[model samples]
Target: MALFGIRRLLTILLIIIRFRLDQLIDVTRLPSWLCILLRFGPWRLVPAPQHNRGARLRLALEALGPVFIKFGQQLSTRRDLLPDDVADELAKLQDQVPPFSNEQARTLIESALGKPVEELFGHFETQPLASASVAQVHAATLNNGQQVVVKVIRPDIQRTIEKDIRLLYSIARLVQHYLPDGRRLRPVEVVEDYELTILDELDLQREGANTSQLRRNFADSDLLYVPEVYWDYTRRNVLVMERIEGIPVTDVAALNAQNTDMKRLAERGVEIFFTQVFRDSFFHADMHPGNIFVSRKHPERPQYIAIDCAIIGSLSDSDQYYLARNLLAIFQRNYREVAELHIECGWVPPHTRVREFESAIRSVCEPVFEKPLAEISFGQLLVYLFSTARRFEMEVQPSLVLLQKTLLNIEGLGRQLYPELNLWDTAKPFLEHWLRDRYSPQSMFKRVSHRLPGWLEQLPNLPEQLLEGPRRPIEMPVPNTDIEHLERQLQQEKRSYRWRVLGIVLIGASLMQAELAHWSPHTLALGALGLLVLALK
Candidate 1:
């Protein structure tokens, strides 16, 4: 099967070359003659012909099977990876792939619950409300007259994904060997990340847990609503959750009908994003229109209803803190601090030129500074930052890319609903207040108080671990044998910590360069902390 998959891939590659896709991709990095050979090689599958290249590419990926479809889905998020036209076309490929039969869905749900369909719900629609590469959702209702929705994983999607993933690995190996940009793109690594995400999405149980947690996060707030996950009816392949009725966030006319405060709605969108990113660090990574709805109950104070919790994101604790700091710095036009923070956070190299980065940031940000706060574009700022960091060899962060994409989608939707939306102004207060509370003395006291029990419990063990770090037992191996092995392990662990510290420093510097000088103190403090961690080792 593996051999056959590769054979089919080779055939597809032959066709692509025959059609001059090799030339379509940037060839400046490859030798001219080699590029020509790649386009018109001995694998003469077909003569070059005019076609909608983007659609052809999508179709070819589908032919190659689920792995490539998944790959294309991810690549769609990376506007930086492909030409705008291609990326725009690819974005339409979301969850529109062929779906498994309704029979399979019924079978899987029944198997998961160990019961008949009649016992589960009053009605189960044969047609899916929506179908994606991994699963399908159907509208349903309970016997007690409560509306609900059923989500079931596509049958054999796991096998399909696994098979395609192996093929992708093979393709990545070949590309890395032959293509100049392969190493930089890190295709294999990207595939690995996608594999993890796709597999996690297949597990409805995990999705349920994510929804439940997020629901809890916003339980008291009327800003966003997550449906209750009916655990009693949930299983690995199937999930049942409360049905929500609201205007799609993208439906401007409907929102207007409900007298929604468009300005407030737009502002709240920005606040929700920043809050999830900074305060909670867990955000709905997929905030596309199909997965979001606006509550009609509070027309003047519209709230968002979010579903499809399969894709989510979280930052490292330090990232959460520094991101908040960076946002605050950007608003204050603290470019030097931004640069320094970037370096400290390891978003750039520790040795990156701070002055140059700061100057570059100023050039990008200065033009938009005097504009009305509502007119400022956060997405544009991020693009500028990313473009600037490209010079310093900043590797693309997959998780950050997801966040960037989601933010863009949300911002676009908000602007559509309400023109003259000043995203920066709306977000500035939330970010500012979040940071203030985060670093405030009272907040520190609260944190200490919250952890007091755990700290007290560990107090007695601290002395023992520190004083008795390591001891030679009576029957210990000779020093040369075990000591060398132990030393090697410790050295490896130390190296890992060293790289992590270096990364932090680099990010801090980058942030400072981007006009966030206030972050310098925190960066320095973290550097000291990182050094302490190294010393302890």
Candidate 2:
């Protein structure tokens, strides 16, 4: 190993020992040899801190530095996938990371943007408004006198992250080799996903593009607002964007003082979530409390102003359909359909028994349904459903992880806004409408119309291409029951449709003559003839 890697490993080991993180693990069920070592060997020499397990874990990660701090920040949003205590503690990491010096921030910004801070901004605050694992933000004004926020990436943090990621990969391989269920946990894959997300966040231009796309998605929306990205001032390591004035989503007292309609706000939060997930299929994935704010202009009709658009989620068509069906099935308490849908969608092994999976789903969902929709927890229910799938060895959909995290965050924020909010009822109607529109005839017609031009472009060469292929040798006729049956079925369907169209034309002809009995015979005859032509279709 390289010297830095070896030193970094030592530092991590020291932090782990100093914080006594091993105490967080339950060693009672471990193998005898390991248990004895942990209990009696030098490992026990270090005294554990007298703090809550969650607090100690958080402090340990913070001590490890920014890369681990970013992991904790991400974990904080995924309350559904984590224990409440740990997630609650990790939530502090979202905006609580200690900031780098202002001089360093200014130097990094100047180097990245190719301009001095003074020339670019009329005034810049030396103290950071917010400090995150990857970057910190400062209040600033453009030369045009417009208020904005300047975000600067930490200098030399990327090297630390890369080194830590290598260490994580090594640990993942060790776990996969030594632990029986380590593959199921997919620790390596999870860390890789985090690596990509955090690395993407380092690119301010990418974030600028994400911000612009989100702003366009909700350009006319009142429920949510996205800040405009100042592209001219954005670069790989520095970002400038329009500053928003609003109350932080976490400040319950301030919102109450503003006379905000808490119920409407909470319900709107759910609506916005469904709209993003179903209607647009694109969502702001990093929606922690720190990244969200509520506009104070309208107390009666609250609007959300979101910042930090580094992570986004989108669903494929198959995923969208299956996920919707699964949610609807869960809502309806149709465990059998849920199980069948999982198999049909290839979420679980094809050979998995439907009855077994159905029973498991029933057990997981039944208790959740016992509570009133207003009192039930969306995150908990989803977590239970996902947990049930794990028993069937269902492969997790990597892309939807972001959506799941965002849902957990939204659920948390909604419940905080209004305890009585019925997320189920608020979101059910929207989902039903989206599904209806997805399968409607008008929707089909729109899709067909979109592809018709492409089909037309390919039409002229299709006949030539088919004829260019080598002709098959003549063969003796063979009796095939399957082909005969299929031919008969197609003929029957064609005859039926032909008669059906004829009947419809005859009825239309009679109505037309009745409406214009005094019209010319030739015009009426032509109309009847045109109606008859529909049978050919």
Candidate 3:
């Protein structure tokens, strides 16, 4: 792996020089010694960059292979973070990677399905409708005359992905070991996450399940359309799903011809994003223009058609709550609450002074508010917010990084679709509504209802614990070695449930004696569980 990594790194460096990427870096921003190294690097012989730096960068990444191409795909979304020319060039990095042999695709599909393609589908196209790094999709019609696409995994891609991932780890390690800011950057963990995400995409069936889940999430809504997964025809290596026909989201001219309400369409996009992130917490992490299209049925109130569910992002309950609160506070200009939320969520160092952090936040946010320009500046506001986060010694949470990337992508997308789109206006109402719904009495009841089964599952074993709770050697009948072995095993497992039940019984006794009339359902549950344990014993 080391030798392979070294060779691969050297080759990447060669490609970088071929594209004259060294010219892209502002060496003046680097330390003096690093600047010296750049001037004296092995590829200094390459000609200087002429123009189209973004194109050159994209070309280099494509040459490097799928892993690098994925990086380019992410960079393409953050137009606010990169030069406009470069972002435009990288945005052209097609998700449709060059296709593999149709013959190979058929063979894999046959192997996965235990039948020839002809037996399953009425017709399978020899050529793929689309190809991507991990898989390709061919247009097909089922025997029942349903139009669908057959998604087949790229041939022998696991080894290639593993090899590239190893190279990434090696590179991350080198940076972490050699640079002062390496730990702060967390290269190894980032590469690890990338590795997991890319590998998960290799499972076609998993993507199918994601599609099904998203479809269910918005079953009653028309804002976003998710293709239906044909489970009978799906496998881990091959997935079959309904095909969709819609105008590409990026085709502004096509949409305008359709008389789509641009402002409503743009706002709907924001609504979909927040709905997925905060409401469901299961968002399509990849929402680039290529994977999204505009449905034609509702031109007056535009709906979206989304595909490619290979990469999904989710947040924990705590993250979802804090993130909502943080965004709300940001809109309200409540710097102190924002700072307290950060500390409460442990996003920043606990030892950090709240007063100083609040002041720093006020400094960053107040400037943006003072600037006055509306929607176009929302993206700029995020850039400032992230910059402030980095400065306050806040440890960037890996779990939320996908959410961060996705929101930025959505921001860039909304701004492009409708320049007059007020992102905050669309988002604030949704956030407020979600927060209100989250704490409503009905919602709290639903939350308890969802978790009740788990607590109930632990109760059956509580009886066994209670029966054995008083098995003192002095009180027990003489035991054989088998019984002794059983006793030992039982001792290991019976630590908490028995004593907790006993404590609950004592509390219930006191409450009943005191004639407390309003014992809550929660208290009743504890008393009932204790009674069952004691009865069983």
Candidate 4:
């Protein structure tokens, strides 16, 4: 495996050299020796391509294979990080690889479903409607005359991905060890996250479930539409879903031709994103233009049609609360609050100086906010904020990074649809409303009501556990007199027993108050009191 990895690494290097991608790197930032080597390498003998740098990069990633192509697709979303031309070229890197043989697709489909294609579907197209690195889709009609698309995982793609993932780890380790900021970047963790994401994509049944959940999320909503997944025909490698017809969200001209309300359409995209993240806590992580469409039925309202649900992201309750608050702070230009939230949420070290962090955040954000509301890029602001936070040693949060990427995609798409779309205006109100609802008394009551039964069930054992503390064998020193030792032990036990009893009584009182009052201030005080008593040594 190590030998194969070395050879694969060489192949990648050769591809980069062949495309002259080294030119893209800033040689001035490199070590003196490496700079000279790159400038005068033997590989430089090969003639450089006539194409521009961006096109060369796109072609080189294509040559590198599916994994790199997917990486390029992800990079394209970060327009804030890459040059506009490069980002634009990378955005054109679609999963339009040459399809495998139709006979192979039929054989795999049959093997997965345990039936012949003829017996399965009323009609199945031999030609693939779309071909991606991981899977390809073909138009089909079920026996029940349901128009659906059958997705078949590419044969042997797993072996290819496995090989590439090993190579990626090798590269990530090199980056982590060699680059000054590599540890801060957490490249290995990022690759691990990417590995999980890509592996999840290989499981068609999981994708089906994701689609079903998303469909249910927007069942009758006008904001977005998710297609129905047919479970009967779905498998680990095979997915069948309702065929959808809509204008690709990227087709601005076509949308304008249909008199689409571009502003409403743009704003709705933002609403759909926040609703998924703040309300549902589940969102489609891979929401590039290719996976999104605009419904033709509602030109005025402009409902979004989304597909490809392989990559999903969700935040913990704490993350949701903190992230919403942080964004609100950023929007309000409350840099001190933003800095404090970072430390409070453990995004930065607890020892981080709040004033210094606040100043850094202000330096990054004040200039951005100076722009007109319509011209401000909310996603870019986040990018800048994260970049600045790196100085304070803020570790990368995989879930938040995914959210940021999706936000960038949504912001770009919204701007394309309507350049004047103020993402701040669309998002602020939604987040404010979500935060209010999340912390409302009714919400608190619901949460308490749900957890009360569990708390009641645990009540019987609480006294014993609290009183016993942690079990450890007692070691007693030799005493001058047995009577003296016994007296000391007795006194110590009495004091310990009293404290334990008091702790139990306070906790019991708190639980009772919680049961009666739900989430009132008195109940909160009692709960804190119980915790404080229990924590006393």
Candidate 5:
């Protein structure tokens, strides 16, 4: 297995060299590259000179396959780390790839659903509607006379991905060890992240489940629509879902032709983003133009359709609360509040000067305040804040990073559709409303009502546990671990408390001594008694 793994690694390296990726970066120094030429030998180089080194590097990765495309997608989001041109170019990494043979697709569907394609669908197209590196979609009609789309995974992709991931890790390690900018970039960690993302995207069943959960999250609303997953026909590598047809959000001309409310559409995009982050905490991280479409059914009040649920971002409950508060603070232009929230959330170092951080935030935001509220971008505010906070030793929050990136994408799309869209106007109300809902009495009641049954069930055991509190073993000598740790802390606190009490008592004794200077013995005894009481405790 080890020898075959090494051989597989060499094959990927040769592919990389054939595309001339070695010239784009310092590759011979990379162990994977050395492993390649040493085993696979004299490589052929493809001439791609129109693009600069960075662009060529991105293009090469795209050519290498889906896993690399996913890596490029992540790099595109790190605007602070990469140059504008490189990040911009990487953003164009298309997920499109040639589809595998239809016969193979048929076999996969039959194996997963335990039925022949002919029995499963009224009509299944041999040609796919769209093809991505991970999966290809074909329009099909279910046996129940419902229109749907069938998504089938590329054949043997898992083996290919596993081979290349090992090589990627080797290169990432070398970059982190030798490159000056590698530590900040965290290449090895980034590769590991990419590994997880690619592996997740491979599981069509998981993607279907994610789509279903997100659909449930917004089932009552018209803001966004997630296609219904046909669980009866879904499998690890194949998914059957409700087919949706609408103009892509990028098709500005089509949206205009349908008389879509551009202003409302743009404003609602901002609202949906905040609601998903602040309320649901689960957001479709991949909201690029290709995956989003605008509903023509409601041209006056446009709705959004979201697909591609392979990547999602969620915040911890604390992160969600702090993020909402921080956004509210920014909307109010309360820079101090923003700074305080950052410290409270541990976004900044504990010893960071709050005033200094506040001033830094003010400097970044004050210039933007000069513009109309409609013109000011929340995305830009966050970008500047992140840039400033990094100077204060703020660590990156990986979950928030995706939200920030998706925000920028949504903002860009919205502004292009409607330049006068006031993101602040749309978002401020939503944040305030969400805050009220979170802490209101009614909300608290609902929470308790949901948990009361479980609490009541466990209540019977609580008194017995309280009566028999600290459990000890009968067979072994007890270790006073709790007392030992508490004793050290207790001693420090006791010393401080003792000094305070002693100082107050001494002051009282001095006053008594002053008043009874002529007959001091009786007053001195009273003072001694007071001191004794103070010491006894």
Candidate 6:
């Protein structure tokens, strides 16, 4: 380690010792020698703090600084990993940080935008509206009289983050090497993932793009709203966006004052989440209460206003399909399908015993399903499922991890809005409808139509490529006897190839017409004719 990393590690050690967070670990689970060492370690000679293990851990993280605090926030979502008390305490870890001087913010913004603060905005507040680990926001008005918020990255934060991240890697290595469950817990991989996420937050331009994409995804929709980003004023270190006014989603009293339909608000929150994951495939991953608000205009039909698009999650086509199926199967209490889907999707090892995996899933899910639909937590169930699957050697999917965190945030927000919100009732129909649409003939036709042109372009070379395999010395056939046989065979193969090519062409044409004309009788006839041509071979 470098000098800075060593100093940072020592500082972390002091804080850990001060808080006595080592007690949070289960010493019995460690190797015998290590367990004995920990039990009689000199660190234990110091009188322990009065706080509980969870509190001590949380306090130690806070004392470590922004990066560790952020890690605590992420860890809190993994209810499947940490004990309940510890997770609850970590959930209390806030990203709030003291703001740098206003003059420093101004200088950074001016340097990023190549202009003075006065030239950039008609009015800019001297005090920050919100200060977080990576950046701070200030209320401002554009010269065009548009209300906006100016976000400036803390000057030299990158250096601080890099230093802390290096120390984190070092600590992760130590934990992985020393702890018994370290490989399973994946401390190193967890740190690597966190590094990518926190590093992304430093690039305001990427965040601005994410905000714009989310706004476009929810455009003209009442369920959620994303503020417009001012591209001209945006930079890698600075972002300016339209300011929104609404009740914070956590303020239940204020929302009630506005006659908000609490049940509707809660259901809409679930709808927004499903729509983002299944419908758009792009979702705001960091959707904690601080980044969400409720529009006051439509109390009867609640709309969510989301900000802080620094972290977003998306699913690939296969993941989306498997995830939807897994969710539906879980809701239907079909553990067999859930287990099968995990193996088929490569989430779990293919060699995993299906019945054993199914039994494991049932054990985790049956207890949860015993509760009333309204009381069950969809996110918590997923956490438990993932936890069980880990025993079958499922590698963590980063996208799914983000989705899990966002789901937990949404569920927490919904239950806060309305205690009796039935997440299963809200999400089941959506997943079913999406799955149906996903494999419908029209969808198949659309997919085939997209690839048909490329297939057609490649079709012309197929016969020649098939005939001439790899480069090799040509063998002369026995004079005229084999020549006639070769000629006959060539003729027969050409005819077969032509017939197959015609069948494919007809099939492509029929699918295109069916998609365009809504599957009329003519298109059906064309499809049948293509199948008949293929059958003739």
Q: Give the RMSD in angstroms, all C-alphas superposed, for model 6.
A: 4.5
lDDT (Cα) of model 1? 0.76
Q: Is candidate 4 or candidate 5 better by TM-score?
A: 4
Best by lDDT: 6
Clashing pairs in 4: none
The TM-scores, one per candidate, come to 0.80, 0.84, 0.80, 0.84, 0.79, 0.90
- For candidate 1, write residues 1-537 as lDDT tens digits: 868676766877765665555545565667788778655666545555565777667666666555577788777777545556776667766557566788888898899999888888899888888877788888888889788999988887788778777877887786766677777666787777778888898899999999998999899798999999999999899999999998888788888877889999887888889888887889999888888899888788889899999999988878777777877888799999989998999999999999999998888888878788777767756766776776777775777777777887788878888888878777778877887888664464345345445544654665554444434344755677687887776667656644544443443343343345543566555535544444453
Write one digit per residue (lDDT tens) for candidate 4, span 1-537. Answer: 778788888999999899998776666666788889989999889888999999999999899887889867866755434566887899888777889999999999999999999999999999999998999999999999999999999999998899898888887797676554556546687677768878999999999999999999999998999999999999999999999999999999999999999999999999999999988899998898989999998698889999999999899988999999999999899999999999998999999999999999999999988888889878778878877887788765778778888998899899998898989898888988988998665575456456556656866776675666445454876566786876677667766755755655665566677667666777666655655665773
Cand. 4 Cα-lDDT: 0.84
The 0-to-1 C-alpha lDDT of every candidate, in the order given, reads 0.76, 0.80, 0.79, 0.84, 0.80, 0.88
Best by TM-score: 6
- lDDT (Cα, tens digit) per residue for candidate 3, span 1-537: 678777888998788788997776666656788889987987787776666778888888888987678756755644333566886798778665789998899899999999988999999999888888888889999999999999998988887788887777877796666555566556686676677778889888889989999999999798999999999999999999999999999999999998999989988999999999988889998887888999889799888999989889899999999989998898789999999998898888788788998898899888777754453355456556655776777655645666766777788788788987788888888889999999764465356446445655656776776877645454666558678787776676565546556654544443453346654666555555554554554
Q: What is candidate 6's lDDT per residue for 159-241, written digit by digit as tens?
A: 99888887788888978877766776677888888889989999999999999999999889988999999999999999999
Sorted by lDDT, highest first, which candidate order results? 6, 4, 5, 2, 3, 1
Error (Å) of candidate 2 at residue 398 is 2.6
The TM-score obtained by model 5 is: 0.79
lDDT of 5 by residue, 241-272 (tens): 99998899989999999899999999889988
Model 3, residue 386: C-alpha shift (Å)? 3.2
Error of 1 at 246 (Å): 1.6
